[model samples]
Target: LPATVTIDQPAVLTASAAGDDVTCYNAANGTITVSSPTGGSGEFEFRINGGTWQEGLVFSNLAPDTYTIDIRDKNNPLCIVTLPETVTIDQPAVLSASAAGDDVTCFNAANGKITVSSPTGGSGEYEFRINGGTWQEGLVFSNLAPDTYTIDIRDKNTPACIVTLPGTVTIDQPAVLSASAAGDDVTCYNAANGKITVSSPTGGSGEYEFRINGGT
Candidate 1:
């Protein structure tokens, strides 16, 4: 005599997720990589988008895209595991800009200045360029005229990501004002007998003020 009876079958569910793409433009650090959510029958829950179902499977920060990964089997809630394949996290406008300079205190100065130092990544309301010209939200590039300069920065909410500090702002002047003069000629009408003399006044930085025709 032999007799036995037992048969139970309900175990086959698979769902997967893997994504990480967000290094700029609205960077929220994007990340998602669910670990265990396979096979049906009792205790298993992880949520995203619809929210609230935490069992933790790594899904941090996450911004700039679409995502939906819900797996439920708390004890057969229809034993769902729908993740057909659709999880994107993308952001690429890439931007990183920098520039700083202030030199030319004399000797042929336009008061030299080049400043635009607050640009990193996209989604910023920043736009400034000099040399390649015209695109200013004003980050100070006043007067400026002395040499090497190429500054460029863009992120007017991602304007094709243009960032170039190339020549790296270098404006210098002050050492080109040497004088040596002497003259004396009288007898026409004696306007102080016309005498002019200025000796050894080299370079330029401070103390040097003299005029003749403009009289001073």
Candidate 2:
């Protein structure tokens, strides 16, 4: 008579993965398939961020953030491995702007101007728009018309981030004109070159051209 002994081999698990690396687009969305524990000794379980374990090894629709994934054998929970990764999602840039100069009283008066300083959080490139018109380069808006206007600003890098200031650029109406002479309104006719002097115009640039008796 002979005695025979049988030995059972310990179970070994193995996993493999091949795909696009995690990024702002992919968002660490991928899968890991286990090919060990032959003969279907047990099923695969997975978890993320220390959450409740779930069946399967596929992850998707993840947002921008850090994540910790662990895969284990359902039959032997102790047999597990953790994979740490981070996902980044691009953020829209920010913009800040300030204005300079003041309202003008006449068309020839100094026009108001706006200048955009260094951006706070977003890209430095900036653009300006007037009356919701076409976008233009640079931060300064000069030689503007003499009327209420809407000023819009945005980050060139991300147009979605924008700010609008209503009636920001305004030019006051032209001031009335008046003329005065050094002496009385009437002058001696045929007098030796009657002296005529004009005073500075009010509420205007002080420059003026007047016609006497409908003549130059």
Candidate 3:
């Protein structure tokens, strides 16, 4: 007498993946997570870009790029389930910002302005800010207080690509003017020998002028 036997094979391996892009400019925090895995031999292990296999279903700390994810059965190592769509991790564009500005002419003038050169190395219209204040579309910032400031620029296409310009904005003003005067008393009244001299005029751009009788 002969006995009949039957064999069973695991279903075809299949899976799907979802991913997230880097939150900040040039960041490496992108992630890819495997989900909806089906038709494998046993408990699943996952890997990306053919890296070492692990039981974890999520791959994190990945840079911005395209990736291939593979899911395999722990029971049958040869059965590898590839997600239908490859994972694509992306990041905000790298933004390079630089700026130069005009210093306030006088103390407390508050009329200083910043001129941000058309930003390079990023996409879309640029927005500007001062010291991380509210964002705006204008490149020139006017009526700024007399102090050191930083320009915050962002890409309209990618808000996450914000950058503080490398060059610091210094809206400054010269200190108020101060001076002392000395006069020589003439031996004779209204003598032509009488002389008044202004000494060591400090502050106010180091330039000074004396007005006799308040005359310009």
Candidate 4:
């Protein structure tokens, strides 16, 4: 006898026939299509990932992962079988990271922060690192010393996807100061204050009494 097939709504493979006489296969890539001795007129219920049942159809758009198919005999409900099938849905997501300024300079200080973002919507988790250090989530940094650093980012998946970027920070030195003085009774002096003021009528470039102060 021709084995009959029946499926519930949502179109999942609920149950099918067992014995060697009954056979089924996914006719298309990323889909599950089942056929039996029973004709098309036989209604079948189908569902995806154990979800609500719906009319059985040839194709469906399911999430990227493994799935199972169940089939049953519409004419003889007593004859039922569950078939296991794996459906691979392709969902390629892209990740990227960048800084507001490609390069920066700090005068005896480290002040540079990078901003990171992902264009893809389904990015589960994100991580970043500096100069191959520990991976950090959110791709952020603070109080970094003056040096060249590399930033790497990755997504949280079976096979993690990673991306790297290069950046630099330079430190500068402070300014210097000089002073001089002259006369028979003239006295050279250095001030503890930040500013140095001189009161002299002879403004010539000669070896005169001199003093220095106000800087480290």
TM-score of each: 0.46, 0.49, 0.62, 0.37
lDDT of 2 at 5: 88
Please, what is the whole-model Cα lDDT of each candidate in the order they appear? 0.77, 0.56, 0.80, 0.47
For residues 22-55, what per-residue lDDT tens digits would candidate 3 score against the true structure? 7656778889988777786658888898899988
Clashing pairs in 2: 94-122
User: Which ranges of candidate 2 are over 4 A from the true structure?
Assistant: 1-82, 86-93, 102-112, 148-150, 165-174, 180-189, 193-201, 205-216
lDDT of 1 by residue, 1-216 (tens): 498887976676666888887656676888988765667774677777777776677888888788888888777766666677778998876676677888888778788898877676666577888888788888888888798888778777556556675556789998988789999887688456777799988777756877878876
Question: By lDDT, highest first, what's the ranking?
Answer: 3, 1, 2, 4
Tens digit of per-residue lDDT, candidate 2, span 91-173: 33334555553555565566555554444444656677877888987767676656666777776766665777433655564
Candidate 1: what lDDT?
A: 0.77
How does model 3 fare in lDDT?
0.80
Candidate 1 lDDT at 205 equals 75
Candidate 4 displacement at residue 138 in angstroms: 3.0
Best by TM-score: 3
Candidate 2: Cα lDDT at 172: 62
Q: 215 in model 4: Cα distance from truth in Å?
A: 10
What TM-score does prediction 3 earn?
A: 0.62
Model 1, 162: alpha-carbon shift in Å? 13
Better of 1 and 2 by lDDT: 1
